[model samples]
Target: MHDDMKNTTPDSHKKKRIVIGVSALLVAILAAGGAVAIYQHSASAQLAEAKSTCAQAADRLRVAQNKYSALINGDEYKSAVAVTDKQVEDGRVVTTLAKDSGDETPTMVACNVEDKTALERNTGLIDKNTTWYETHAKTIDADVKNVVKARDAKTLKDTQTALGRKITDAKKLYDASKDKVKDDKTRDALKKQMDAAGKLKDGKDVKKIKDAQAGLEKAMKTVNDSVKAKQDADKKAAEEKARQEAEAQAAAAAAQAQAQQQYVAPQQSYTPTYTVPQQSYTPAYTAPAAPQQSAPQYSAPAAPAQPATPSTPSTGGNTGSGPISGGHGCGSLCTSAPTDTYVR
Candidate 1:
């Protein structure tokens, strides 16, 4: 019985130990699960915060870019300085925090911030020049039109002045990166564009303003020459007609004189036949005074009828149709000696 009791006691102790070990393992597993849960929640919350900050930075960059567009396009906009301030303010804190976190992503965030700063700076410079170009382009276009229209020497001169100024300004803007741009190809392209614009704006270039002016002058000369020629022809014709009329008048007078001479004035009745001594002596009466020679009338040689030169009209009377001829006063002048009309 003692042996059996000893064996039973050992079995009971073994069972108790087994129950204690199972309980301790269960407790350890539950503790480990709780720790993992807390860690996951904390990590998710930090990720959310970081994402929100990044989003704010991105939003600021977009807003700054929009403002830049406004400035470049010449719309009323926030001052450039104000836009820069806002961009930096929004991005600085996020960048600082990202750097402090010592995470691998901080380098990327830093680079993004730097890029944004550069964007703002470049756009600000470009915007100023773009605004200038916009205003100057309009002025130049209008001035060129005026120069072409009136062929006004003064307007042409002013256009040259304005274009020169614009070219200089554009050159300065484009030359900024000449030494600094890393890409040689891009730099050369920029320079070429600037040079082209400058050359086109040059007043001395035959293809530019000078050419248009020359064309206008040539057009005017042609018109003037045509008008003068027409006038001269008309005058010659008028003089010839006058001469013919004068000759006709002289001829008519001569004929009338001859006719009068042919008529023998009847001898006064002094010799009248001694027919009827009682009959009163009646003198044959000559036709009352022959009609006085009236001055010959002449039709003005029809204005050297200018051959009608068809021409396209100009919006402004001063500018003639394209450099084609008949550019001047060759229109029909009915009896009026001269009239100003634009012909081309």
Candidate 2:
């Protein structure tokens, strides 16, 4: 009985060893199968995530492309877009590799991050430019409208030149007529107007230029009127002076003709008359007694003396009347007589 027990115990020990070896083998197989299943699930999830990441990145790229299209086509912005396009292409290559290989590499992740960052930067630039343009749109439109108006109406330069010419002509006329202007106040007023016109500038407003032109024209007209009035006045004054001088000359001529009508001369021819007195004296018979006693009584008997006769004075005339007187015994025989003679 002791020998049979020993042999049975050895066999039982051998069976326990075999059973333990089989259980260990089955456990190892189950653990390996579970590990494979876990690995496959994890791999599928990573590929799905990679595909999602790639799709999101592609959407972002499409959005960036749309933004780039909307931005202003400038040299600087286009160059920046070109650089971003290269990054997007790199990201696409990484995404395709990740999707096909069902693997996510650090390199692919980095490419996606870089692509997104570049798209964000490009979009920011586009938004900045859009905001700036939008803010100043009204101001730019106003400027453009003004420029167009100026161009249509005779450009600002041409308008300025025409205005300058008008001013120059007005100045010349003013200078020519200033000396003839008689009124100081009017001349000064016109001068002030001209100065204002001269100072006109081609500013932004068209109304101001038109106003200046009108003012200059009015001033020129005023100057011309003043000059014409002065000339007329001078002409009238000259005519008046000439008429006065002619009247004075005619009066002097008439006075000289009236002084030749009064003259006088001396006369030479005269006759004179004279008168004699009406008295006579005579002697008696003294001559008869002297002859009777001639020889005997010649010495005794002397003849009586005769009486004296009066004489008459002659008058200073062509004919004279007077009485003649005689001496001794011829007093009575003398008679008064008148004398006549021609005087030349």
Candidate 3:
């Protein structure tokens, strides 16, 4: 039994050695396979990124063309060309990098070739668009300024006609550039330029000229209405002043006639009047008559008796009758007596 175990052990050890060598060879083959798989995967990812970047660069070139067309129509061409040049440079870099890398599949190789060819063609198209836009922009600027400066209606109208001619020429040059571009990115860019030019031709663009025409028409109508209203007011005022003067003249004439009728002449005259007061009657008084005067008679008283005397002697003469006297007494007596006695 010991001898048989020893004889099989050497052959088994040889088989074991073969199995270990085969396992080591399998591990090394697996590691190599993994490394190859990782390298292929990394390379494929970079190629895809390169293609996507190249495509974006193509889109930028188209945008630069559209901006250039608008600038030409609006008289801004210098800035437009600068933008296009920068986009073209970026696209060329991406194309060169993609062409040199590993691409195992036939389809990947074809895609890479096609992308490089497209980039070379785009370079010429971009230059053409830039050159045309700049030339047209200069002409448009001068034409628009001349139209605004014209002297009269006839001259201004003539200037506008010339501007229309320049716009048509620019539109032709823009169309020729569009035909050279083949890709979707280039075609889309050309379409935008066509649309902007169409707006200018139709007179639909927002511009200073259109606004100025509308303002002038409104001002002329206002001036005409104001002139007519002022003439009517002046005529009415003159008529009112003439009527007031006529009424004042008639009133002055009537007052003068009434004053003339009140005049009179002057004179002086005199008249007299007599007046007496009345009296009542009163009675007069009378005195009574005096008595008459008469004469008076007177009576005497009685006397007493006396004695007788005796005789004297006697004489003798004549005695006649008587007798004798006495004689003596006794004796004589006797003698006388005797003679007387005898005569008797």
Candidate 4:
């Protein structure tokens, strides 16, 4: 039993030494693993930080690049091609940096920051220029529109003046023509048309003026035609009156000749006859009557013989030797007197 106990004790001491060595090796490995885990965790954090920084830079560059593209495409900034191209180059450099490994070098970071700053500056300039161009374009457009409106107004004014002159002249012509027209209806119609044309005064309505001008021209034509017709009628009336007067004169002459033929002077002759006159006697025979003896009867003394006068013919048949007058139907030897004979 004593010799067995001594061998067990040596075996137990060897086993204890083995167990201690194994425990020491396990502790060393665990310590080494913990150090490796801590290093990996630190590396992951650094990678995440680098990625976040690169992403931020990429975002900035993208925003700037978008701004530059928009400006270059826009109407206001299309002319700024040279400046926009430089900005595009800067954005390309930033894009390259962002696409590289997350472990960004100091030089790359610096380059990206510089490129981003340059892009921001270029984009700002483009924005400013675009804004200025937009404002300027609006101003120019407004000015052009105003100028066109002014020119149109001037043209309208000139046209109105010319139209006024034409209307005045037309009115003068119409007045003259209307005066010449003798027809009441035609003259009144012409006046009405002229009045309508007169309503086309100077105004803003061009259509009204043109319509009035047409009316005026039509009225002028009507007046002229009326005047011509009236003139022709007057000429015809004058000719007819002259013909009537000539006919009247010819009829008067023919009537005079007929009256002269119907009223021929009657031929008349006058003859005178002599008659002896008896004279009465009484005074010288008174004494002889006293004696009463049968004396010779005293006859009345015969009248002394008178000389006969020649009868003259009367030119007007008014003269007559008889006491009675105005006798007609006398013979050629008898004297004829005229009663009342009117010569036509």
Best by TM-score: 2
TM-score of 4: 0.32
Count backbone overlaps in model 2: 0
Q: TM per model?
A: 0.26, 0.33, 0.25, 0.32
> Which residue runs of candidate 1 sit more than 4 Å off their true CA positions?
1-11, 70-245, 256-344
Better candidate number, 2 or 4, judged by TM-score: 2
User: Which residue ranges in model 2 land beyond 4 Å of their true spot?
Assistant: 1-155, 260-344
| Alpha carbon deviation, residue 154, candidate 1 (Å) | 13
List of clashing residue pairs for candidate 4: none
Measured with C-alpha atoms, the lDDT of residue 271 in candidate 2 is 18
For residues 114-195, could you state the per-residue lDDT of candidate 4 as single tens digits? 2444545444544444444444444433433443444455556765666677677766876676457866566566567656
Root-mean-square deviation per candidate: 43.0, 26.3, 46.2, 26.1
Best by lDDT: 4
Which model is ahead, 2 or 3, in terms of TM-score?
2
Query: Which sequence of candidate numbers ranks them by lDDT, best first?
Result: 4, 2, 1, 3
In model 4, the number of clashes is: 0
Q: Residue 325 of model 4: what lDDT? A: 39
